[model samples]
Structures are given as C-alpha cells and as structure tokens.
Target: MSTRLPALITHLAHRHVSVPGLLHSGFGGTEIDQAHRDVLDHLAHAVTAERHRVDEAAQTVMRGATTVIQALSHQMRSKIDEMQHRYDDPGLAQHLLGLDHLNEQNLRHIQGTGVLCGAWPGLTHADSHLGDIVAGAQSRIRGYHRVQVTSQMEAPVAVVARAVEPIAITVAELLANALHHTHGTLAIDVSLHQAESGACVVIDDAGVGMHSDETEFASRLLSGQRTILLTELGDPPRTGFAKISRLMRQYGFSVSIDKSSPYGGVRAVVFIPGNLLTLLDEHTHPMSAMAPLPRPTSPTRTGTLPTGDAGGTGGTGEGLPRRRRRDAQPAGHLPAARPDQAPTPEETQATWSAFQAGTASGRAASRTDHLEGNH
Candidate 1:
C-alpha cells in the first residue's frame, strides 16, 4: 500500500506545475475552481458577443426587406395612377382607383415595417409644416377623408429636417388607428398644438374607448417602457402600434392614451418635444404635392374591417363592428424613411390585383422572412 501510494503520487505529479503556476493549474483545487470560472467567463463573453452579432444581422435583414417592399409598393402605386389617368373607361378607371388605395394602404404598412426595422431611406431633411406632416399621415391612412387635421400653430411651425418623416409615420399610426376603430364614416379630428416643451399631435376618435389592459398596453408602447416582440403582437400580428412604439422610442417622443375624447371615445396624444421642431424656413415648400387626398364617395358604413382582421367575417372594407377598440403607442425609436416612387396607371388596371394577392411569389415569399420578428 505504501509503495502503491508513492507510485500514484509520482504519476500524479509527473508534470507538476511550479509554485507560481499551481495557483492557476488544473490539478490544484483552487486552480481547478479558477479554471472553471475562467471557462465560464469566456463562455459568458462569447454568448454576449454572439447575441450582438445576431442583433446586428437582424437589423441588416430588416433594413433590406423594408427597402425592397417600399420599392414594390411604389412601383405598383405608379402603375395604378398612370392607368387611371390615360384610360378613358370610367368604370375600369374606378377599379384602378380602388387598387391605388390598396397600394397606399400597403405603403403605409411598409412604412410601419420600415419603422420597426429602423430603416427610413426616404426624405430625411424636409422643411415641413405641421399641417404637411398631418397631411402626409392622413394620406397614408385608409380613410383619409374621415380624418380632419387642424393645426393651431401660430407660426409656420416646421418639423425639423430629421423629424419630418418620423413625425409623419407616428401621426399616420395614430390616425390609422383612429380611423380603423370608428364607424366607417365616423369622423376623426387630429388637432396639433405646439408649445415650448414640444409639439403635440392630439387624435380624437368616436370609436369604442379602450379597456384598462389595452390602455395599459398602449401606454407602455407609447412611452417605450416595453420592448416589442413578434410573439406578443397576436397571430397574424397587428404591427401598427408596435411599429409606432419603436419610432417613438428612437425619435425622442411620447404618446399616451390616458385621456378620453369629448365624443366619448379615445383621445391619443403624441408629445413631440421641442427638439424635434424647427421654424419653417421661408424658402421651404413643405407640401410635396404628390396628389390630392381622395374624398369618401361611398357613405360611411358600420362594420368597418381592420387591415389584418382575418377572423369573424374576414378583414374586408366592411365587417368590423362599429365599436372597434383602440390601441396605444410609445417612445421615439424613429428611423428616417424615404419611400420609393408610386405607381403608374397601367399597373393598377391590369396587373395590380394579382401582384397584391401573392401571385408574385418570389418577392412576396421573402416578406415573411424580413418581417418575421419585426412585429
């Protein structure tokens, strides 16, 4: 036994480390503990590093996807417009007009998509009026005619160059929600108020007011206190509020749903601090003059459908209940957006419906990939 013990010790100490190295060697108990800790530290750092890489890759993919969608959306819109103008058939032209509206709605969705991914490649520095921004938002929403934008800005108030599109997108989300919830033709009022602290975009709707949990959710989003995840947005994902929340966080803004409108509906207030504003330069033409907003030729109907409402009666122009609920948005995570050019009329008349429906599979298939985690 004695001989065996010496032999065992000799074998164990065959590669014995020097005294200084023993403190870090794998053989010593303390050294073994330290080695384990070192390995853990390395693993932690590797995980952190990998997470950053994944995040960066995701952003890149999102940015690219937004760019492509904007392009397709713009092209289709232009085709619809040109077909409307050149063709003499009023009936066919009307159909084209409908397609054009869908294109605009899709554009709005894409813009929101861009907002989520932090990719706004559009006009960044514009000397834009508060009304111009409101108009832009109104133009993007489905029921633009139903939204009345009133500005009490005494001076020629401008959204600073960096803030123009982000402000527009934020306003669009607020306006879109307001329009979505109300009776098909029920009017929404968006009033703009500017003060020293910041600018305010107040949206009042006549739809059913929000529940407490919904209100809390909206508040969290608008304040950017919560981070958005794809899983949280519900299946088929209503990305509108989530999109605006990201922009609000990035752009140094705040939105709240704490107030009730005079019409017994939801009142959403978007607070844009003074840093986002600039006095309109005399040389600037704020309005882009793309096209006039369309009036609602059809009567305002009840049962208005939301964009992604697949349940109940399917998300159509009509089917949503009049008392549709409103959601909230938060913090300023705004990305500057530059949308692609819009459609020509021919594309709207003949080809748009098919393209819109997913007949064009190549690009459409990738849409999910780009927006997978974006919601």
Candidate 2:
C-alpha cells in the first residue's frame, strides 16, 4: 500500500529480535509467536490505510476529469454549430468550412477523454485565474504612450500563492516606471519558466536608462538599507522607488535598474528565484539563479546595479548619514504620483509651462533622473 509496507514489516522484524532481550524469563517460542502476530496486525492496517487513500485519490481525479471533459464536449459542439451556420455568404464559405473542420477536430479530442490531464479542470481553473491578473495589468497599460514598446512571455508559469501577490505588485511598479520614464516608445519582455529545479519571472523594459549610480542605489534597497525616504516630494501618494524596492524585499526578490536599451534612460528588472516561491527538494536547482547570491544584508546595488561597487564610496549612500534639509522641496512637489501609476506626472500648470518654455522640460527631466542626487 504506499509501497513501503514491506519495508515496515522488515523494520518490525528487527524490533521483534529485541523482544527476547527484554523478556528473558518468558517462553521463547510463545513470545516470538505473540510479537509476530502484533507485527502482522500493524502491517495489515497500514496496507489497508494506504490502499484506501489511493482509491479515494483516484476517484476524486476521475470525477474532476469527467466534469471538465463533459463541459468541453458541450462547448465544442456549440462552437461547431456557430461556425457552420453563422456565415451564409459564398465568399465566406471557405473560411467557415475551415473553422468547422477545426471545431470538429477539437470536439473529437475532448470526447477522447484521455486528452484531459489527470487533474485538468482544477489546474485549468487556477491557470485561468493567474491569466486574468496578468491580463488585467496588460489592459490597464494598453493605451499608454510609448517611444517604442515590445514584449515577450514564456511559461509553465509557477503561480504560487505565497509570492504571487507580491510579485504582481512588483511587476506593476516596474511597468509603470517604464511607461513614465521612456520617451517615445517602450519595449517590455517577460519570461516565466519552470525547470527540473525551480521557476522564475524576468521582466525587462526598454525606456529611459538610469544613471548607473542612482540605479544601484535603488537596487541595494533591501540588502543593507532598510527604510528609504521614497521622494523628496512630500508624502503618501507620492511614493518613489524606495517603497517598491521595500515591497520586493518582503518576498525575497530583488530589483535591478539599468538603461532600458543601448540608447537611453532606465530599465528595472524583478527577479524571483524558484525556492522563494516554495521549499526545494533534492532536485530543485534555481532556474533564475544569480551568481554570488546576495546576502540579505548586502547592499542591493553593489554589483549588478549601476551604483558604485560595494566597497566604493559611491553606491553605498545607504550607509552615510542623511543630511537634514530645512528648506527641502515640499512633499507635494508632484501631487498625482501613486505606487503603481506610470512614471508620468499629471499635467499641472507648472509642467505645461516647462514644456512650452523648452528649457524647463529638460531641467525637469534632469531633476527626475537625479532623484537620488548625483552622489
């Protein structure tokens, strides 16, 4: 029954040998007989339990499969009917005929029943839910203007409950940053992979490249720096990169910011390794492993970030004492910013004036890139 009962019986035999040492005065043959009987009884119970568990699991799987197959069968028939009669025009007949053939093929596959994976319906539903969350983000950013935009996605998508939500938030943050920082068009690339070892999600955006120093500063957020004042501009809705960086840390992922392309501004990539999503086993190798695995205390921006090296004076702004500013810019410098909004600032009287004056737009852009200071 669990394939281990025989081994268990062998173990009990070893224990039976010990019985004689504890009961020296007992009749040797009778003692052996009782111990043998006890072991046999336990072995029987264990086998029965394993078999029952196996049977129950098999029945549940069959029930789920049947339900999905039946639903698929009905859906396929409806599709066939719709395709066969929806178009009456002679010119469209060829296309309709092809669709009908495809529909029939699908119907056959469903009716085969064997086509469904062992626990297909449940898996399908789970995948569908993840697809929706992913699609929703795509939909929200669909119409945002871009200098250039492109995307790629790969799958067997590890959609774990523990890290999924945090990763989603991190993705939204990076996507928004791409839209806000890039000039004309932006390109986005996303990859999700599950291997013999683990899983990973990689997102890349081509837009405005960030200064090597500043990008490193943001990335090292989790390593040695705990809390970062997100914006020079005042509080709440005005959250800057620091907040996003912290959130990524909460789930054991790190953010790397670099130039989007050979040409320009900033690119932020969020890397979630497989083990953080779940516990690893004997076979789990990291699919998206980073070399010199970062220590939780190491500055995030140390090596991969444009920020200065870990020992260099430049990147570790996190360790320096923050200079108090009595006349610093008020937190309300940009009132419309939010944790997930595209990096775009709301059109305000000041922004319009700057755009029209020409010089102001350049200066405003400069101030944005210098977010963490030229240091």
Error of 1 at 23 (Å): 40
The per-prediction tally of clashing pairs is 39, 21
Error of 1 at 243 (Å): 1.4
TM-score of each: 0.58, 0.34
Candidate 2 per-residue C-alpha lDDT over 249-366 given as tens digits, one digit per residue, 9 for 90 to 100: 4557666666654334454555655444332111222211110111122333322222122222234334432212223223212112233443322332232222223221111221
TM-score of 2: 0.34
CA displacement after TM-score superposition, residue 345 of candidate 1 (Å): 17
Off by over 4 Å in 1: 1-63, 80-96, 121-125, 281-375
Give the top-scoring candidate (lDDT).
1
Q: What is the per-residue lDDT of model 1 for residues 1-375, given as tens digits with 9 covering 90 to 100? A: 333334433443232422123333456567566665575456556655665566567766767787677777867865665675577564586476677767778887876777676665243444455666676567666766567555544334456656666777778888887766777646777776656566688888877877887776676666677556544566677777788788777778777775578767789888877666555332333223321221122354332211232222333434222221122122211112222433466654443343233222212212322232332
The Cα RMSD in angstroms, rounded to one decimal, for candidate 1 relative to the true structure is 17.5
